[model samples]
Target: MPSDCTHEPTPATQGPKLLEERTIGGILVHFVAIPTGVAGAGIVYLLATNEFTKRNARNALDWHLTVLALTVVTFGSLFTYAEFTGQGVTDVATLPSPVSTIASVVIPTLLTLWFLVTFWTFFVGLIAMGKATFGTAWRYPLSPALVDRYGSELDFPSKWPFVIFVYVVLLPLVIWGVFFGSTDGAAFFLSAFGLLGLIMLLTPLTAVAMYLHGERDQSRNTDWKPHVAAFVGTPILIAAAGYVISRVFTESMYPPGDAMYVFLAAFWVSSIVYLVRWWMTASN
Candidate 1:
């Protein structure tokens, strides 16, 4: 299970407690990832609509988009290289070369590290604002470089280009590559990516919900029931969709590789729905 360290603080009287009672790893798994997953979906929506080009919001959006892009590029390139090279495809019980083991383990470890760093960067920023004695302030060092190019003329698009890209480009290509490459690879990639996307989508919703509901009041008791509900509901829906996709693709049987593809697709669709709903509610 992931950590839940990103939970909102209670009343102002009590000192700030760590978001979760568990360790850092536990908080990452439980809290940080959920909202981050939701935010990822929002990013896709923004990219699809070209909202990143706005003058006011461009800086923050671009910074986050860059992070998303880098993550995709890093993981995609490593996986592709591994697949083409056939570095670790053979049965490990037969004693594969040291090079294969190194390549296989190194790539994932680096990716995991990347996730941890990115999560911490965002998580700490959020916490700092929450704990500020005066007004909230959060900053990212990379924001300026990311927003430098976009001008004021671009308007947010309704077409959702990023969502389309996820469905039409990234998800399909990754699924195809993984399904053909190895079953374990397919399962791992799908679950990992799907989980990541889920967090991106969820995180933003939580933020927006808190903002709208004015949940940060010092005197009021924090009600975490909604957050907990969303946390549990999102993953179960994703899993259910994965199961359905697996059954469909494998003639009522679950093939590990194809099931991953199906699950990811389902997860993407669910995210899109959530984003649209949130946007509508927020706008209204």
Candidate 2:
């Protein structure tokens, strides 16, 4: 009887502990990968005892490598500028001009390509990090072939409908603000996120592409009652949170740009919560 009591509790406790470990592990690898790049991911991969952590680390490593490759455009732009002017590499912070006058179209065109490449990389990485944070399975778009080689599909159903709010509402708004493509004045206001207010946008389409390619969770069903409820509540909460943050927290009502930032942050955080909750409920 005594042995049964101690041993019984152990099994139940072990399961939750392992679950917590896996979740933490999954989050850690991605977080580390963001700053140190492949080296950070490789360290976690080497140390992880479980497959879940290892899988996340491997993907993070692949993602960083992809990002590195994409960043080559910046170097390409710099080199072309240098070759045109016949100067060696110098401080990038101070805008270095080509020592020689190259073709009029060359520098501007290369710079535009570099900017687009940078934007694309930023958006893709943002989506991958969001998936990791939301507990969704994310295989990076344009990730190296190595990410799939050892990655295994888990049996657990990875469906969460709240991911739609991300696609339907937040990201589009962010891109619009960044490009100043719309009349919303979102590009002007500096909120708590300030520059990062702009951060919460630009990845929806990339995420959608990932989803379409089966690089993300397979479930996006919006019809489930609880998910439907969450979906309905999301926008309302976003608006409300924005209002509260602006009116109650700030000195005065925030400008449209700042308000937009608050709303986006709220939308993203709330959507992730709903997705995780739905995942947990369905998994059980």
Candidate 3:
């Protein structure tokens, strides 16, 4: 349904479009976003040209982007923290002050954001759909104007949602599933795969964070090319690092201590690669 709905927007962009085309495209983007989430809106935003369609798609896209991000912050953060902390014998108090302090601060603020954005998207999105049907434009509250601002100069790839979705949603679920009381050979295989997936997930999350931050900072370069390159290349780097670690450790695939260093090392390498790509691209 999301794919079928997105096709309407792309074709209309190629020619002189009418009110009917723009209206339909706008409607499709909003409704598609409801089920397909951020990815659906992203596809429509990248392809659709008519101002009504593009603006609404971008607005929905940005809101859903925030929702997707907050989903991880609210739902996934504690799970991730438990995962790592559960591995070792250190007390939660022994964790760096920043870790505990940040969690305390983030948890409450995140709850507030959750409520505001949910209702904001619903009211605004419904109005957007209704108005678009009548050929009127509706913009979301507190929009960063991502499309209106950087859109002209940048060539944003449509694949961003795929990258974002995997990291933001899919990998976390997989990691949780694999480690759900793991044992023996199955544990080994899952651990190895999950280790790699976790490292890879960070790359996309950073990509999203950078884009959101860059949108606010005028000094940052807006080109999406380097981001695209980093995400594409980082997987190989992650896998290779995992392979080396697995070879050196041999039987230490289990977590807590055996695989912790390896996972951290791989994550470090990916972070380094991401920064290099960002610097080379002059991204902020």
**Top candidate when judged by TM-score against the true structure:** 3
- What's the C-alpha lDDT at position 258 in model 1? 49
Instruction: In angstroms, give how far residue 215 of model 1 lies from its true place.
Output: 26
Regarding lDDT, does 1 or 2 come out ahead?
2
Residue 257, model 2: Cα distance from true site in angstroms: 40
TM-score against native, each model: 0.37, 0.35, 0.44
lDDT of 1 by residue, 204-272 (tens): 443333333332221254332233235335645666766766667657544554454454565555545
All candidates' lDDT scores?
0.46, 0.53, 0.58
Model 1 vs. true fold: TM: 0.37
Misplaced by over 4 Å in model 3 are 1-21, 75-77, 80-93, 96-102, 149-284
lDDT per residue as tens, model 2, 76-193: 5555454444443332323344433343466577667656755665565567666766665477676775646644542223422433444446555645655554222222332222
Order of models, best lDDT first: 3, 2, 1
Q: Is 2 or 3 the stronger prediction by lDDT?
A: 3
Give the per-residue lDDT digits (tens) of candidate 3, residues 154-261.
Answer: 544423333444454444455565566354333444466565545544543445544543332223445634343454445446656666677676765553443444
Candidate 1 segments exceeding 4 Å error? 1-34, 37-63, 88-116, 127-133, 144-148, 151-182, 186-284
